[model samples]
Target: MRQGLIRLHCGVIEIENVSKRRGRVTVLDGVSFVARPGRVTGFIGPNGAGKSSTLRILLGLDHAQEGRALVDGSPFTALRRPLTCVGAVLDGSGAHRSRTGRAHLRWVAASNGLSRRRVEEVIELAGLESAAGKHVRGYSLGMGRRLGLAAALLGDPGVLVLDEPFNGLDAGGVRWVRDLVRTRARAGGTVLLSSHLMSELAEIVDDVVVISGGRIAARGTLDDVTGGHGSLEDAYFALTSS
Candidate 1:
């Protein structure tokens, strides 16, 4: 399918026939999808359906056994400064327990030659101002998620990849994340977010890609993919239960 490459304001991702394996078991089998600029593309599927594996390949954390994953027309490792092209939050618990939230951001900023002013801006943007000076060890799961999101934004990359960002959020936190993602899209960023829950995705995603049995079972805008289906939940059920 031409390797799926196309120029986007947030850069481009071309994934084609990407498959992966762990020992004798196949985790991903001929999976391909595109995340365009200015939209929240929700990657949803049943657990063990290869959603996480696809994301891992896209983020360059793991290599595919077959096919390819490319960013902006180039392999991820080939980018001179990768973070400048994409920001990712694949894990929410990578922060140091002893460091205050602001301190953690400061170090990350310095590594990228960014200023502390930028750090404070994102901290406030993520609604972490009240918790900025506190150690991450004390932050609740929802709070930690906010901090992780702030870290991802510090790069101001045009592309963002968030894995299960709403997993532990409360109602308020969930709403906050929804707005944050939408705002990024409006600003011309491409957002690829993964979630196991279809109900939550129905509220935030512009398009949905359903993965199942280590492959893409359905993909399109919510309405295009769902068609006459009662709901995203119903469409999901039909695809996986077949």
Candidate 2:
């Protein structure tokens, strides 16, 4: 984890009063959350609760009509090398199916001026070395996910924003992601993960931010958010069902 050794000057993610309107539909209304360095912050919400929208705005892929999304006190677009500052895996395969996994990673590395050695390192880190030479079309969902993660690690970024990363993995893959996330946080890197798997999130997340109806329903440390509830799942149902 050479990238994990890189010092994060300001790795905290602060989303303040972020609101978005899409064709008269308010996707996010006054949403706010904070993810600190060396912690795994779980972002959870129901479908259409604006989780994806918030991430997009934070990454500078989409604009927010109101409020601000800051990474280490500055917007993502302001960074000199965005990839090095933050690595993200959104909700899909970020590579072309026709291309080999290695080819896809090589192109991404070239785009970011990353060395071929770095790409190879990430491939091994992501456990894609065995299948990297195969075309993406033949790769399983878990393999594709590993490839996506390998690309994200190309820059050895300080911040990781992953959405539903455990969607299509076997038990081993799940454990791999869990260990990887924990390792990153322990190394003083910030991690913001969004997933519907309450059980898994409960196990690994140190803090959580729950969004409901385009607004933040609750935000705090795992114990704080869970309160007196028997489990995180119970608390989630209690908050979102209301």
Candidate 3:
């Protein structure tokens, strides 16, 4: 529950005609989609289909050979107070194993000028209350994920970019992430989630953008994309199997 208050900084994610190449191997080819406020856009594709590549480009972690990825109409690297504008959870917790969960969060908060109170708030929200004092080195995969999510929310950001967010989670953790992302969208925030978990993605996503072979396969509302299939999973196979 987000207290029924809309986040004022809700942002739009626009990835337009983005293409990337690594040593003559195309990673993405003319991939384009938009994740607007109050919507959870699922970016679903098979392994090596460029889901991570596109997100990395959107986060300014890699260069796109052509086109552009924009957050709130500006490139991610060009944004002021970047973390405040977008909170991302990519790969893993991203916390150093030697540091306690709280230490890692506090460090990030301090660097971003975020208050310690905010860090604690996110820790609570992420259900890492008891684990906060434990070193990340000992945390389980689910715990590390919670820590990553907690760090992402420390800024109370309006835009969230998550890649395989459901990985390494139990049923309860899955529900936790599902509810959290839904709550954020309901609060007028924008979310772009990249995952190959068709069933899970179908539950919380409002829009669907399917990519394959380093290119876009389909894009539309959930119902629109799954209309002719038995379910999102069936549609996913139908769309990407070619």
Candidate 4:
């Protein structure tokens, strides 16, 4: 099977035959794929299909029972000054509710040895200027997401891992994120994001990796993965339903 092997290159996201279990129930079964630079890769899957599990392992937030997840050809934890190489937005802002958005970003910057100026830069980049001073608890869902994106951008990293990046976003916000990630990819950044909004994903993803039942159902460029299908949605349902 395609997933039984892993071919890794320097400066890309690589997952090699990773499997995981919660007690006896398998969450991932030899899940493997790569996200290359200069393109956007969309990871799509139905709920409980192991999308989050794989990403968590990639980010070093979880351990795998087998196989590996690597960033830039090395395990994530082995990278010195990792934030400067990879930035991630997972599970909302990950900030204390009592902290103001600006405070949260400043704290992240300080922890990462990033400059305060960079924090402001990302705040503007994320369109969070007006809301930066508000406590995270008072921020709207979209505002919280913006804060997370802002923090993720603080290091100006070359790789981005985002989950549900379009969640809580309006049409305009979605368009903003699409443009942002496309620009990043155009600048030779490796962009990996997972989202359930297939239509929005189809607009920005250069490649697609679909997961079903904890394994890769499809992995290829958008055109190849969507072959003969009416749309990404059509291809997704057809692939997963089998």
Model number with the top lDDT: 3
Error of 1 at 143 (Å): 1.0
lDDT against the true structure, per candidate, is 0.83, 0.89, 0.91, 0.88
Tens-place lDDT per residue, model 4, 1-242, is: 22111111324999999999999999999999999988999999888889888989998999999999988668998976677778899989999999999999998999889999998899999899899988889988888888888888887788889998999977777888899899988877889999766988998999999999999999999999999998999999999889
lDDT (Cα, 0-100) at 90 in candidate 4: 91
TM-score of each prediction: 0.92, 0.95, 0.95, 0.94
Tens digits of per-residue lDDT for model 1, 22-104: 99999998998888887889988888898878888887789888999877667776865565668788769468999999999
TM-score of 3: 0.95
Candidate 2 residues lying further than 4 Å off, grouped into runs, are 1-6
Which of 1 and 3 is the better model by lDDT?
A: 3
lDDT (Cα) of model 2: 0.89
The residue pairs found clashing in candidate 2 are none
Instruction: Give the candidates in order of lDDT, highest first.
Output: 3, 2, 4, 1
